[model samples]
Target: MDLNPKLPTLPAFYQQRIEALLARGSRRLLGLVGAPGAGKSTLAQVLASQWPGQIQVVPMDGFHLANVELDRLGRRQRKGAPDTFDAFGFVALLKRLRTQAVDDVVYAPSYERSLEEGIAGAIAIEANTPLLVVEGNYLLLNDSPWNQVQALLDETWFVDVPQDLRVGRLTQRHQQFGRSAQDAADWVQHTDEPNARRIEAAKAKADVMFRWDS
Candidate 1:
């Protein structure tokens, strides 16, 4: 299936830019960072799909602390906040992915929204994969472990979209995942909006600022 047949194709310039990185023949990590509903995951998937086996997506959501752990730490209410993730663990994974031996296959965790948990070893980065597209809200964050991520990425793009559109997307996503309409709206206003603000502050650090609506 075509991942982005209806959506506009990635610009020729961006495609060529990514191709140049692959041409270097060294494993490279490209990050797509943005607010919760700004389309980073979709963009990463579309780009990776275009390259088939040569590219793969490794999402940072996979580092989200389990609900049980979050509750224990009194952060269950702010599950998507930067502090709710295992930041150090994510940094470690990025380092491994960057320096893995040519023949080594590295496994990474993936987040399951329905279950609200992280499943270990759900993604495999094969030796032949030249590009790994990492998407997350904190890739550009200036905090400790998160700040460490920027150095590992060869290039990081900040995905941008209108705030109203992002809030609408977040509401629908929450409703689809079993929240009531009111609850979804409340969550977006109280939870996601705050996180979005934090993410927006780091946009300046991106190598490229991308407006998806274009």
Candidate 2:
């Protein structure tokens, strides 16, 4: 795992708290979600590595609409918008992963970064496997789809970072993924920043706040 990014005090403590929660839940599921560049994925990975119990992760990114689908809908430019994901499909998968009682392998969806789309049957969430952690953006929005999804999460934590830091990181991340520097900056300043603001407003809906003081 890359530790290039140091762990801030609040996020580290949040990770410990998640591990303790997993220990107590034993067979129950837990969810960690936040906006883009909010560090939810990193937190999930850290917690999973420390959890002593059997752990499995089902990321909400797994439900992202395929690139082809986006193109067909004329929404390729607005890829990460909440409307772009297959909310119903994600809800179905979450329901199955949360309540099904079979012993066979439970196939969970997974998102492919290179392909920039979601792939079904890419991950298996082994039936009855405990300690499921789901992470993603827009999991706590009070609106229709997000509100519906929140009901499935046993516990939810929102990762909060300074606005400046988040925008800087997001711009860099976009450039790393092949976006032009100018385009990346514009995306971060416009689309991404607005989304971050919406998510920040939803922080109050989270059970806990995972923030970095520094």
Candidate 3:
């Protein structure tokens, strides 16, 4: 893996690669997989911005089970874990995106971090979108429905960042979302770190891997 500095050249470099995929004239799904706070969303946004109408971002966070459902399943504390999401539903959506003719608009769910819930049909993938950037933590996980994800993507890239830096970003994110300092630290120690380990284990599955420093 190469250390990819968060510079203008990096996005430009990737834009060229994405364009090559689009040149094939088929709808393609590109995955950006990484642990929490690893900047996958930022990278996806940059790519989408580079190719206005040609690329659309459909994040995996959109499939998160509602808080009510999580509480009922007793999985609220492990909200970001694999089991907490509608894995099959996510897979179904991807299948449709991959197989259906891009003649009609497709609606996809979107997650609202402020509400910690998913809003249905929040993102619209327009007809003939050449590239779909799917950002998620579990995209490379070799488990059940998640394993189905990699096969659907034309390319998958894993974002690598130093553990300390990722943890710091996560800490700040938790605080920004209303967690007390101590509570945020505890959650990171008990929840996010374990998920991070699981995400790291799948790094070998990525077609390409790159490190980013924010």
Q: Using lDDT as the measure, which candidate wins?
A: 1
Query: What's each prediction's TM-score?
Result: 0.95, 0.87, 0.94
Q: Write down the TM-score for model 2.
A: 0.87
Each model's lDDT? 0.89, 0.73, 0.88
lDDT of 3 by residue, 85-138 (tens): 999999999999987664778899999989999999999887688899999999
> In model 2, how large is the Cα lDDT of residue 69?
82
Candidate 3 lDDT at 43 equals 83
Q: For each candidate, C-alpha RMSD in Å?
A: 2.4, 2.8, 3.2
Model 1 segments more than 4 A misplaced: 1-6
Rank list by TM-score? 1, 3, 2
How big is the positional error of residue 205 in model 1, measured in Å on the Cα after superposition? 0.6
